[model samples]
Target: MEILESKEQKLFARNLICVGIDKCENGDFCGRIWEPYDDQPFKFTGINEMVIHMDDLYDEWNYPQRALNERSFLRTHEMARTNIIRDDGFVEKIDRLQKMRGEIGTFIVQVKFRQHATWQGVVVWAEENKRGNFRSAMELVHLIDHAINKGLLIK
Candidate 1:
């Protein structure tokens, strides 16, 4: 994770924003890494084209039978409510991270890219340095901003 730390240090040097993150009940400060795209095409793309309905969204995040080695918990939305909406700094912190990532869509892409690169422990750097060959992050931000302006809100 040294490379990730170094990147965060450079970001701090440039924007004075530290990469300090709070422990999330489910995932990132605002939501799961996929939460932003939960109501979008990306969700289906990741889940073998399964359309997530409202009923499925409301399902509990409980464990299976509450075994001795496992523990039950709240639903995804409930966790989001507690860890994101209930956290006063969640929105700002998420926005800042998005900015650090260059944009929300860019952030999503980077997350997936990391996932594909390392399979797990996404914080780990890839072996090959395919730097400066990716698509423009600002272009994606513009598209996302346009969609948001057109009354986009959680499908």
Candidate 2:
């Protein structure tokens, strides 16, 4: 999968919710995609967390390694593609294509899906890209509200 970082906010087709308004150690706020449609909690620091979550998803699917484009899955499997969001309101798309089979090893490879950047501006890109369908979104909101009410979302 390919990753990208940009100040353009229209980069992603889906927008996650701002569950926690708390800032990180760097004074930047974080938004959690509580349910990234897969029941796995996806937390991203700024926008790069999108990459982190996708990478984790890759690991969960391949088990021990990420999907290596034409060298990861078999010829009959479908490619996995998802559009990531950018801080500038743009889209950063990641496409994982055909996986290769029958080669094994235990060396861990580090994947880089982000670029270097410093906080030079403030746009609060989490203004859009609302995720999930109607019912799902409502369920998420209700769940988070319940959690917050029960002191589960905040301490």
Candidate 3:
């Protein structure tokens, strides 16, 4: 496990994002991405599309679960009552790690710092057991893209 130096840093663990690549025929990942609160993982066909989804998750995870639920209160009473969702199970699944890994490729992204509206963190290419640090969201994408295209280390 990675060690971070600040009190707020511990919170990053729950917000980690997992990407499981089901297809990479065109050199871009095509698979499902999971966030801590999602009842189900989301499917995407390309890196650009996946990044968009991840960005949304990044925004949502920045808030406390209670704050997220309170935001739901802004919806109409019926909608709010019906839309209550708990991420406890989702959190457990990710904590176990790679139970959601895909057949082709898998990445566990830990976005430790969110400054200048971008991410700075480490990504683990789980299949090859390789790790790399990224200074921005784009860097993370490129790191994964490069690994997929150049070929992962053969086990």
Candidate 4:
């Protein structure tokens, strides 16, 4: 329920990445979001950046029946396959985000919820004024790098 500035959202949009999970026949496997810990702000991370297990967090909300409809699902999957730079950029940014987090404070990351019936797409959310700043984009990238290196994204 947090309203982020268009600038921040744009930065986030540039930073966000989505990946496709083929195993999900009905729905799609989007990317992930991480916060330092519970009660902390949420940040978006791309699909390639983390190896997520669909079973771990996959649920009714992420894979709703409406998202499974033939047309919408196909479009979502197609988008995932075609978007390459967005995917690669996500990986690169993650590396930078994590590194910055280490220098600033202790934190945990989690998946941000987009909406029901959006296939694998995820929306970034944060506590009001609690979200990271433009200067922290590098740190956000670093956090992603660490998650990838640690295999935290792997399911």
Candidate 5:
């Protein structure tokens, strides 16, 4: 995986979405992926579709952890890539290959996939300098749910 410098300009120019793989120090394949949204200048709504490879499934039960270090579980499987959607108007595609490599000896996991697998997570960011006074992550989650049901995340 390549660490693309997430600059302010680049983030603003193109819709920025990130995918990461989590694993133990050992060389064990734990199928897991993460997608995050940081729409600074624009107010993003949600994601489109998250697609992942199917061959990476190891019995479909034993898999990597999908939740991030923050303990936010998307309620998806580990072997199968998951997708999350927001309500605003932004979409991010996630996959195993796009996972970020661990830093120098920092005790991290590696992301690998025999085939191309992808998943989409929808996210909504604040509008450009528009403070709606929206508080609480639950509120944001509700908004995302609404967007998903409305089919607004689709391209």
Candidate 6:
């Protein structure tokens, strides 16, 4: 994968949602997720939590507002990706990307498909320009963790 070292390099295809991963103070992965049309990034703490949140978001998006069971997904689908309505004045995509890259262990993620109760996507280690494919959400988290550890070692 190409390293997005310049401002002109678009993170992914315009359609795919791009997620930025940063190492938190306690060594947990902090996620900054950006949908296509939305300028504000949705922040999550751990990788596992982030995965679950994304799944919830997806479910809520595809289905009605009614909650299934006790877990309630945010009704953010209407505001995400779809450009029918615009509340925000301008897009801050570049700022978010730059912030992610400034972190200790930066990763750019683009989830392509969700099937069999898990995620399948590609992740890029920003500092090293390394790319990896994940078969499942667990695998995705493991890949990010491994990259963070490897980055620490390299430094």
Best by TM-score: 3
What would the TM-scores of all predictions be? 0.19, 0.23, 0.68, 0.19, 0.19, 0.58
- Of the candidates shown, which would achieve the greatest lDDT relative to the real structure? 3
Task: Return whichever of 2 and 5 wins on TM-score.
Answer: 2
* C-alpha lDDT of residue 143 in model 6: 72
Off by over 4 Å in 4: 1-87, 102-104, 115-155
Candidate 2 ranges with C-alpha deviation above 4 Å: 1-27, 36-40, 46-50, 62-155
If ranked by lDDT, best first, what sequence of candidates would result? Answer: 3, 6, 4, 2, 5, 1
Better of 2 and 4 by lDDT: 4
Give residue 51's lDDT in candidate 3 (0 to 100). 78
**Candidate 3 residue runs with Cα over 4 Å from true position:** 1-12, 25-27, 63-91, 152-155
lDDT of 1 by residue, 1-155 (tens): 11122232111111111111112223222212223212222222221121122112212222111122212385334322122223344454444443423122222222112122121112211111111112232332232233323323112
Model 6 C-alpha lDDT per residue in residues 1-75, reported as the tens digit of each score: 222222322345333445576556476778677654456778878776777666655544542222233323764
Worst 10 residues of 2 by lDDT: 97-106
Name the lDDT value of residue 23 in candidate 4: 24
lDDT of each: 0.23, 0.28, 0.64, 0.29, 0.24, 0.56
Task: State how far residue 98 of model 4 sits from its true place (Å).
Answer: 0.8
Return the lDDT, model 1, position 32: 21
**Can you write out model 4's per-residue Cα lDDT over 28-112, one digit (the tens) per residue?**
2223333212123223243333333221223322322232432433443422222222334454455444433222122223233
* TM-score for candidate 6: 0.58
For residues 25-127, what per-residue lDDT tens digits would candidate 3 score against the true structure? 6656789887655558899998889877776565545422222222334573322221212344554655655556877878888877766656777777776
RMSD, every candidate, angstroms = 18.1, 17.5, 8.0, 16.1, 18.5, 7.0
**lDDT of candidate 5 over 2-53, digit per residue (tens):** 1111122112212222322222234222322232332221111221211222
lDDT of 3 at 126: 73
Give a tens-digit lDDT track for model 2, residues 1-155: 11112333321122322234233436333544332233333455653453345444443333223324433455645535443332243222111100111111000112222112111111111222111211222233333233323423221
Candidate that beats the other on TM-score, 2 or 4, i.e. the better one: 2
